[model samples]
Target: MGGLNSNAELRRLLEEIGWSPYELARAVNRLVSPDRRIHAKTPFAWRDRGTVPRDPLPAVVAGILTEARGEIVTVDQLWPGQAHKTEVWLPAVAQIAPDRWLPHDTLALLKEFRASGKAKTHFAVSGNELTSLAESWAFGNHALMSNRMTAGQGRITPDYIDYLEKDLAELRRLDDGHGGELVLRAVVNRLAEAIDLLSDSSYPADLGRRLLSLAGQMAQLAGWLGFDLGRHGFAQRMYLLGLRAAVAAGDKQLGALVLSCIAFQQTWRNRPHDAVSIMGTVQQGLRSATTPRVQALIAMREARAFATSGMHSETSAALERAHQALARGQHDHDPAWVYWMGPTVLTSEAGRCYLHLGDTLQAEQQLAEGLANLNQDATRDRVLYGLSLALAHARGTGGRQDLELACYEAGQVLPMLPEVGSARCRNLIDTINAELRPHRATSTVRTFIDKFETMKKAKIC
Candidate 1:
């Protein structure tokens, strides 16, 4: 062990998994090396010289073996004398199951994670893991053990619950105005506080329900911020957390909302089958509790999912249902959360679905209407739909007028990017820039690029 003895542990682990030394080396290289063609001599050297790979490669080796072996393969097992070494983050780090977590253990784990400052350091959920979490939320039968933990010892009041709600509303406003990057940490902090309050206080059952509902809302907001920041796995976990809180609070409507949020994220990830399935579950659950606006919102989301999955007939039907539901919705009867889910939002969503369906004409028409009627205060939505409209025009006939209009719409989105710190928003702009590449010779496109460059110099976008 002094110098570099043979890596007997790695050799044994590879042998146990029926993989040759070269295969193990190939897996590591494929995962770690961008070129993915590391020489087999590397593995030979490690086996003979007892050389540990680099900082993370040892962990990567363990992970590949774990997946293939269908069991937890510790780094120490893969490379002995490394028992004290931590497994650094890797591509599949999010997929690594936490030790001893059962269905009943989820709420406790979520609480413990929120209480731990270390958990805040990274966003560590993968899409597949997220889908699993979402499925559990939708169908799992585990119950929260109790709300009466000894660690929670405070006299909670209605005013305190109201204060939490107020905080949630304010944080949501910041999220809408400034994007997720600026407001996510604040929202997560508030969500943790809400969780604490739920457990720490004794109150009437109604008040307790309200507190739980507040926690659910906060969790949903946190999830939204997670998605906006491009932490899809984290977003999925947050959504499931919110769903659990909502279920515990006896708020079916809130639970449906959380499920719909997951569905939306699934659609974003191009897993339209999961998205559609999740939304169908949400719709079924919401039937008794939903307002027309809420129904419309869910229907539009379903339409988008269907469109993305190439289900043309289902997409058109869902869109029609959304429009019909919206027409029947009354502003006063809608929930506070659904207040923003108006005809304008429906138009924007319909436009999105059309774009996915490859109907640029319909996409442009609905997007234009949506933008025309969008509230001025919706900074993020404006930029998003603006970009979407620009994209629709770009994908259209590519006429001078179409291209110029696309550039104009894209340019209009620039000013707001200063206030919008969302990675998703930045990604949208990046996409628009890529879309306009072919039209670089056009003066309008050139002006758009110049303005964007100026904004970059000013650190606006």
Candidate 2:
């Protein structure tokens, strides 16, 4: 057991945490399903016999240790030399340089991302790092770079810019319908193309600014796709790069848009304070030229942050500002990215905020209105908002739970689940199933469980 195959690191970590092998196994089991549960003695084999646990166990164990220690732990640290197979890769934030947002840095990142293949290491930016980046963009007073003709053969024109913008819009539409997994590679490719043009092409100052803005837009979209796919570290890197591009273009509004995206990711990661801070940076940066729609979008994100942090009064005030901003109507100078930030999208987000705030009735009302008005082609949104509605119904008002209505609402989203490939949507479905498990005696809950299981197995098959 003390020979070449010994896992000294695993044993050391177990000792440091003061956890017995059985305790580690129990922790892993809690995070996984009953059928996938490991034996109580499994960690003994791992630590003493140097046996590496299969598939997700290593990652799960690492996560357990991370939570217990209040720090980041990785599978590689637990089982050295073992191939890591994790659902989501969370790399150390320090591994990514804080200032890697310049044009050459972005090119290198794109090259690395393209070459990394399927087993890419995802690096999450620390909250402090994100805040610093936001502050830099907001107050750095970044001036547009003077036009310099590069030696490469690519030539950019207004017609080309128009075509690129339309192509990006189309990519957004595809993502809305099919989710990130289906569209991520395409987005990366487009972002790479845009970067190449920015780095290799010779254009006038105006065209150069336009190209930079386009690159920022592409980076923002790619970042969002990465987030939707649960590659958060990769998402943050793209977001930082996008912010850099926006600054280079002297596009304060685009920079604010990128910051809002970062704030959204922070909210999802349960760092509401960081989200609120980033949103504040966005709001402060855009105080002069922000359009009504843009303001509404920013306020909605701020409201989400407040809701996540349990700031009821602040959340209400932010939502009111969002609604009031929308009431100002669309401005002629509104950015193209705010095209989707209308009543329907705002209502859905407000519903999400209320859901976080534990007001299930209000959540249900807002989500239902949003769903009813949602475009039929917005399959991913429907699944997300629909699942939120189901949760609200499951929780119900006062002391009552509407199991039947909950199942019905969830069932409505079941068929559309396969149409999109979002991990978030899948996670929400799992959450709903978990919530409904207690009422398994009820026929409605039983039927929903059966259908969900059948669909899950079918996907595997």
Q: Per-residue CA lDDT of candidate 1, range 287-330, in tens?
A: 35577887888888888879888888999999899899889858
Per-residue lDDT of candidate 2, residues 162-271 (tens digit): 99999999998898786666588888788777767766777887888888888888889888888887767678767876777787777888888898998998788778
Give per-model TM-scores. 0.76, 0.82
Q: C-alpha displacement of 346 in model 1, angstroms?
A: 0.9
Using lDDT, give the best candidate's number.
Answer: 2
The Cα RMSD in angstroms, rounded to one decimal, for candidate 2 relative to the true structure is: 5.4
Q: What are the clashing pairs of model 2?
A: 123-233
For all predictions, the C-alpha RMSD in Å is 7.1, 5.4
What overall lDDT goes with each candidate model?
0.70, 0.80
Cα RMSD, model 1: 7.1
Location of the lowest summed lDDT over 10 successive residues in candidate 2: 89-98
